[model samples]
Target: MNIQNPNRCFLGVSASVTGRSWADRLDARGAQTALAIAQRHGVPDLLARIVAGRGVALDEVPQYLDPSIRALMPDPDSLTDMGAAVDRLASAVLKGESVAVFGDYDVDGATSTALLVSLLRTAGLDPLFHIPDRIFEGYGPNVGAIEQLAARGVTLLVTVDCGTTSVETLAAARRLGLDVVVIDHHLPGDTLPEVTALVNANRQDDLSQLGHLCAAGVVFMTLVGLSRRLRDLGHWTADRPAPDLLQSLDLVALGTVADVVPLRGLNRAYVSKGLIALRRRQRLGLTALMDVARLDGPPRPCHLGFLLGPRINAGGRIGDAALGTRLLLTDDPMEAKRIAAELDRLNTERQEVERAVLEAAEAEALAATGLEDAGASIVVSGEGWHPGIVGLVAARLKERFNRPAFAIAFNGETGTGSARSIPGVDIGKAVHGAVEAGLLVKGGGHAMAAGLTVERRRLGDLRAYLEGQLAASVETARADRALAIDGALTAGGATVALVEQVAKAGPFGSGNPEP
Candidate 1:
């Protein structure tokens, strides 16, 4: 395949000046030495040069390439409130208290819910799960859902991938005499909800070394903490096998990659180990998914992100997101195969809808600018646009324009929107600002992506607000778009041996991208 301008907008690096500075640094740092090591390891010289350009140290290569849980994982105790969360959950399990897991509908939420449910069941606890509908209930915990769960005899509620910004919902859960434990990765607001324990890597004052962990990774870490606590309390013994935390790494990897979280620190370990476990076909659901997707070999990050991720996301985006969680948690091969096939069909349908909506969104966006041509940032909204595919449309627009983009689905009186941003522009902050300005009913996300709900009347104002906030940053970001090659090399340098050696540095995604 032809590599299209690999240096253009290379991971949002500025090519003209900053890119040159990076190149100069690489040259001074003995780029040739790095290239030689790449060659010795049988990796492409171009990739090696890129790695050298990124200033990754020689000693760090092992950790980057051959990430091992034993070597790279941080202690669970390092997370704040982790001990308390584990203790609370252990008590619930021992007391046979019904626990409810409130999770988001996305891949991270689904996978995290699956991991926690599996872990609880392994410890002999029957855990109930609740995933809010993205279209109906929105992102996080809602008061209605909490009430329903509490009424169902749920004494403890554990929220994964969401609930950090859900102040009112959590407060309601507390009022219902339910203990709440929140394990999330989203950035928090000023006053956190009153909960039994809040465990999030993005907590303002959190000092956890694994800040890059996704929701599933956080859930895994919490399980580790719970296991340790149980061991200390003499509740677990060698005769009773400890919860196999490693078994959940596959879910962690799937979530981390699908959610597009940065793959650094503990995340690297999860993906590396998870990929190995996935390749071994330990999970019938994942194996069936691979078969449905026509993947003949072990699933890679690309396959997960492009093929499998979309299929899993389709459930949450269009159909029932619980389908994804069920697919991951099931043990029966035939059932897994059936679910995989359904997900595959849903993904195909999603793609078709997305294409039609994208065209309409693009037309609306061009018309809004009142020019035959528009600049980098594109924000557009239209009636009857499917909320499920708005995020994908935003992503496509961002790629085409090389700028921040937002696509909104207008349904007469109400609207839902998703935003994708160029590097250096914080889309989450923009969404937060809109919320603060009362332009949006609610919005939250990371720097690169965000979601929002707004009154149809506020569409114009929302667009203006985003444009004002993103204008300068978009220009700066676009002006700097250039591909900065790590180094130049002949095609002869691209070998299977080199790819394998470089593969060791992989499980690579956002943040710790593969060179």
Candidate 2:
């Protein structure tokens, strides 16, 4: 077998049907490393190239292929506020104080809320929880919700997958004499919120370098810290054992994959181990969901992301936002089955609404910038559109147009918008900037996705602002948007044995593409 030159395009196909070039994923150095990997490890040449193309170092191949939780799990206290957050949680447990969890409406939020609630219940505490309505309460904690919890005699509030930007809301909670602990992963605003402990890994001052984690991942680490603290305080005994944190990996895996974070480092280990737990089908709610989704075989990341995630998300999109959390937290099989069936029906309804919105949004996007060139970014707004369905529309538009996109649902004076960004573009930062510039009422998210609110009159102004701010970066990203091919394979060269060897690299997702 002869190796092609690394400088040349794979199979000499410069341009494909997608109007994109096909190029070697491996450079000269990477090609040499692949050859070395094949020679040293005695693996198939294609498998070696795939591993090398993903930027795995020569010595790291063994660990990369086998991502163990013990090897990849970091110390819980490594995060900036883990200790302080644990202290408050432990105190709540010791004093048997009333606690409440305020979570977002998405899968990440539901899982985070469920995970925390499960841990608290194990410690002999019955914690109250809330999943806000997407349209009514919007994202993150709101004023009225906090006041309601405080009225219920809640002494401590723990917000998951939210609260990083809820400065005023958490401050209000503080005013009601409630201690707030925020365990989140979203980027923060200019001024940090005044809370008991904000245990976000993505905070500006955090040096954990664990920013790739999703909200559920952050919650898991916080629980680890809290569990340790509880143990130190003699909260566990023979009669009352500590919660088996491993059992909750199923939730972590669901949120981690559904949120679409980069599957690298700790995330890789999480999904790898979490799949093992998920395969056991121990969680009644998930098992019911699996049955409804017709998932007969073992669960994988794709199953979680495409099947189960959509059903859970359907509740937040069109139905009751609390349905997902209720489904995940339920211990009764009958209740889980009922909620799962309702979610399945809701998902079908959501698909119809999403398709209608996507069709309208695509037409609007095309008319805004004809087929010749789809400008730097696209901003599409429609009257009377479902606000909950805009995120799905924005994602579809971004994929179809190959750039950043925002789908706005207008209702008279104001509009709710959801944004999806391309590789190099930072839509979250752009939203925050728009907020600071008074172009948007409020917005916040991570790099790949975001949500925003703006006055209907300022739609054009927001579009122009985004184009000017993101043009250079979008152009640079699109210029290099070639499809990366590790190696070309002939029909005769493909074999089952080769594929089996490639299976060494398991659980691929956003950052780790399947070969």
Best by lDDT: 2
Q: What C-alpha lDDT do the candidate models reach, one value each?
A: 0.80, 0.90
The reply for model 1, stretches above 4 Å from the true place, is 1-48, 370-376
| lDDT tens digits, residue span 1-515, model 2 | 11233355777777799766678888788899999988887778888999898888888787778888778889998999899999999999999999999999999999999999999999999999999998888999998998999999999999999999989888989999999999999989898899999998889999999999999999999889889888888889999999889889999999999999988888988898899998998999999999999999989899999999999999999999999999998999999999999999999999999999888888988887975588889899999999989999999888888889899998889999899998878889999999889999999999999999999889889989998999998887767767788777899878888777777786888888898
Query: CA lDDT of 125 in candidate 1?
Result: 85
Which digits, one per residue and each the tens of the lDDT, describe model 1 over residues 134-229?
Answer: 788878889998899888999999999988888988888888999999999877766788898899878887887566677898998888888887
Candidate 2 is scored at a TM of 0.97
| Cand. 1 TM to true fold | 0.90
Q: Global lDDT for candidate 1?
A: 0.80
Which candidate should be chosen as best, given TM-score against the real structure?
2
